[model samples]
Target: MNADQVLQTIKDEKISFIDFWFVDIFGELHNVGMPSYAIDKNSFVNGLEKLDASSIVGFKSVNNSDMILMPDPTSFKILPSDYDPGNRKNARIFCDLYDGSTDESSRYNRDSRGIAYKASKKLKEFGFTHTNWGPEIEFFVFDTINVYPSPYAATHSYGGSGYSIESKESPWAKGNVSTAIDIKEGYYPSQPKDTLEGFRKDVCDDLYNYFGIRIEAEHHEVATSGQCEINLEYDEMIQMADHVIGVKNLVKVKAKRKNKVATFMPKPIFGDNASAMHTHQSLWNGKSNVMYDKDDEQAQMSQTGRYYIGGILSHASALCAISNPTTNSYKRLVPGFEAPVNVCWGLGNRSAAIRVPMYNRNQEKSKRLEYRVPDPTANIYLLEAALLLAGLDGIKNKIDPGDPIEENVYKLSPEKKREYKIGSLPVSLKGALDSLSSDSKFLEDVFTKDFLDVYSELKYKEYVAFAQTPTAWEVSMYADA
Candidate 1:
């Protein structure tokens, strides 16, 4: 769908208002509201409007501060929301950020969705079209939370943030016992034990109704304390990013109203499973799944598919900088609890970075690879585009991944695993950044040097801030020594 279809749908539906959506560098959502009268197709597609880029986090600068929002008509959705103008009445379109002048500077340089768009366009130049992505975002809903730590706090105390949670370490510092849901018991556990089925229901309903996303499923994950996963239909690279940004916004708002807070932090607790956004991907060749070759013996996998997986795993270390891009993200990448620890692929294996679903309903297109390293904290657009390009590069160059292992990778005989070329991803933020700095050609092309400079500076600051913090663990380990 193009801008013309966008205006026609609104006019035909008698849509009252339009929300032009965009994201900042930090993957936060922002919008521009417009009256129906300003719904010009060409103008929307060209991204003609005045806005300040400096306001976006990490995109801060005083000099070249111009930005514009160009609507993506295909992303038009009529949501069931308080903000929604009565069912199908208020419509919204995801937009591309551009410069105000002719030869529009990419307005979305700082936007993940924009970066994905740029990357997808670049792929077409190399004779590939349709960059596809499917992100499985996981999050936790808590009854309450109340702890804030700085560089100097002695015990990271928080006895008075209100909203009592039965299992938190904050108020009494008893450290999550009793009220915490049992480990691994939360998956599909019924109403009373799962507790947040209402919220999960509400989230799925709101997402589907508001965003027009046909959620494939919503279920309680293995993590305790209300961990959940809401998956939507696969979408193209850029729009899927927009949907992701929108999902986060709607989830937070709805969660707040329910007298709770939601977080996608990879690890919010110790000794329990952490949240992960395992991304599932497959290429298409005009209505066919290119990843599946029904005639092949290895899970009906195609050679092109093997190359795609190869490229992704080869770049696995560098990819983590973007896929698992936060300090807390490493907390979830640890061994055990279903977290992927090494760069490996196998048939129906969860221990490897990529897992192929074992039991499909005898469908060919259902074939896909699940990249298990990503967390919900990532900018979906950039993460997906990067993986797609890596895979495309592998396909273009026929990068072989050797062979797929069927053994339990985590428990593999140490020497045997090494012999098979298995390796671990970066264990720290600094390491990921360093890896990205080296294997950065793909990322650099999508995000210009301007973006790279700003992003690196900001991420390093975050790392330093984390490094400077005085944690209870540090003091406990060193106070007496």
Candidate 2:
């Protein structure tokens, strides 16, 4: 939408509040609202809104904290207000952050969305028109949660499983625990078992209606305790990142309205499947799909696609720092949870880090690689940018991705893995950070050194903080040792 269209929509819809949205370094949305009367073409173009950078994590020091928000007119939308109940309505617009003091109003170096824009521009320079991304974001919805945690103590308790279910409709209330879906076996079950169907539908509806996200599919994931997934249609890189934040927020808010809790945490449960955001990506030059080849001997992917996979595998370790991005994220990356730890591409193999999905045959548009390392915890802007850079590097260097492993990677013997040249993703946050520190030349082209350093320091501090803590398992296993 143009500025004039935005104003006309506000006027026609009687929108009272216009919320300006932007992301911090971690992809968390921050917003400031103004009365609709305050918005005009001049204010929208000149970028009058100011934000305190020091208040945002990994942004700025108190000495140099001022930043400006310039709302992108194209991102203007009418959002359903949570607080307003009268005829007055609400709307939202995604903003790009700029240096308030700069004469040119240069983009903030730490703005993840801006970084994605820069990355996309770099892709065009490398002969690729654009990079497209589709992410399958999985999350868990719980009926209730209770927790207590501090330096002196930590304990958590929740109820959703058959053992502690309090719902009167639950068979467990009538002494039929067998009615509960078993752990790690909740994929595509019907109604009573999939209690979140209505909720997930509502979430998807809101995402489509208000946020402009086109959801392709929604269903129960491979975890018994309220795990679900909603697959959104593919979009351009920066737009996809914005949609991810929108979908997550919509899901959480809709779940809360039903007195439930939604979590994108990689490993909220100990022994079951953990949530993951498997990102499918492809490169294109206008309407033509550069990643597809009908006559390729190995999988219909083109030479460009192979090189892109090669780049991802070559930098798999470093990519984890941004793709996984959390201390708890490592827990989900471990074996036995269907985690894609093996650094190899495969056709329809879930265990491989890169999976070439076998869906929609004869459709060149659907030919793409799904990088399986990322979780919902990642900053989408940075993660997508890094992925695109890796692919671009591969195209530039003509990196060979090696053989596609057809067998299940998890079942491959150690000797077989060695023979196939398969390597593992980083096992911990510290390991991933170390890998990024050593092999981040690709990212340096886009991310400022200071910004990367700040990001690394923040993540490393989290790792150290978690390492310093003693867990309940430690007390149970080593108290006597």
Candidate 3:
């Protein structure tokens, strides 16, 4: 859409307010609202509108803080809600941040949206035209939640009391016998066991109507209580990143309207499956999928594909610093959970960080790699940019991803893994940061050192806080000692 089209949209939809939304380094969405009457289509589209960057993490300091927001006309969408009915409708647009004060106004390196866009542009230098991405986002819905933390004590609890199988309305409620889904068994259960189907659909409907993002599938994930997964059709990295943030927003909004809470926390629940945003990626060179070659015996994967996987494996440890940024993210990466913890590539092996999805030779377009290491907590822009850069580095340097491992990597002994040159993913936020501190050259150009320093410092503080915090387990283990 152009400037004129956006004006028409505001006029036609009776949008009273427009929210310019952008993502911080922490993947949190920040918005600046403007009355519809105040929008100057030409000026806004040209990047005249400014925002205070001092308060936004990973941006400039207070002394040098004004950032410009160039509203991407293509990202115009209606904010789905009944809060303000009829003519009082609200709309949203994704913006790209830039250093507006400079004579040569350039995109801020910390502007995650700009970073991803710049990273995507690098594909042309490598002879690839575009990178297509599909992310399978998993989340949980809780009927009630309370997270209270203090300097001395902390407690976070969440569960569905009324929606349990023992509820009076549930089918299992009558026998007084427990019919609740066993831990890690929540995949594809019917209405009684899976109560969030309608909720997921409502969110999907809004995504489709509001942003034209197509949903490939929506169903209960492998967690007993309210865990769900929503699959979106693949698109380029920048657009897909926007869709990811948009999906999260719409899902939470829909969940809240139904008096439930939705969270993308990697490990919100203990001893059950954790949520992950497994991304499927394929490199395209114009009309052909560059990652596929039917003549190749190895899952019909091209030489380029192998090298890309090699790059991803080589940089897996460092990439985790951005891909799985949270301290809680490491909890989900441990063994016993379905999330990938090994730095290896294999066909149909979910335990490996990179998996070459198994498909028929006839289905060349389906031949792509699924990066399973990332969780939804990651900043989508940075995550996509980091992945692309690593893969591109591999292609340029001809990194050799060793033979595919068919065995379950989680079950492999340490000695066995070493023999195969397989390595474990960083087990903690601190570990990932340490890996990033040394091996971040692959991410250097796209993710500038200035931004990375801020990112690392912020993440280190998170790790320190978590490391020092006393938990119930600590009290239980050594109360008297």
Candidate whose TM-score is highest = 2
Which residue pairs show backbone clashes in model 1?
Answer: 79-210, 97-107, 98-107
The pairs that clash in candidate 2 are none
lDDT of 2 by residue, 1-481 (tens): 8999999999998889998989888888888989999899886777865789899999999998888888888888887554345656789889888896333439888999888988888976777788789999999887765553344453334211121323322333454354466778788988777888888888887788888899999999988778899999999988899899888877787777678878898887768889999999999998888999989866888988999899988999999999999999999998898998789999888889999988666678888999999999999999999999898889889999997899989999999999999998889999999999999998897987888999999999999988987776776778799
lDDT, model 3, position 270: 68
The lDDT values for all models are 0.75, 0.85, 0.84
Query: TM-scores for all candidates?
Result: 0.88, 0.94, 0.93
Better of 1 and 3 by TM-score: 3
The better-scoring model by TM-score among 1 and 2 is: 2
Local lDDT at 168 for model 3: 18
* Clashing pairs for predicted structure model 3, backbone only: none
If the candidates were sorted by their lDDT against the true structure, best first, what order would they fall in? 2, 3, 1
Alpha-carbon runs more than 4 Å astray in model 3: 45-48, 82-87, 101-105, 149-151, 154-179
Q: How many steric overlaps are in each model, in order?
A: 3, 0, 0
Alpha carbon lDDT of residue 97, candidate 3? Answer: 82
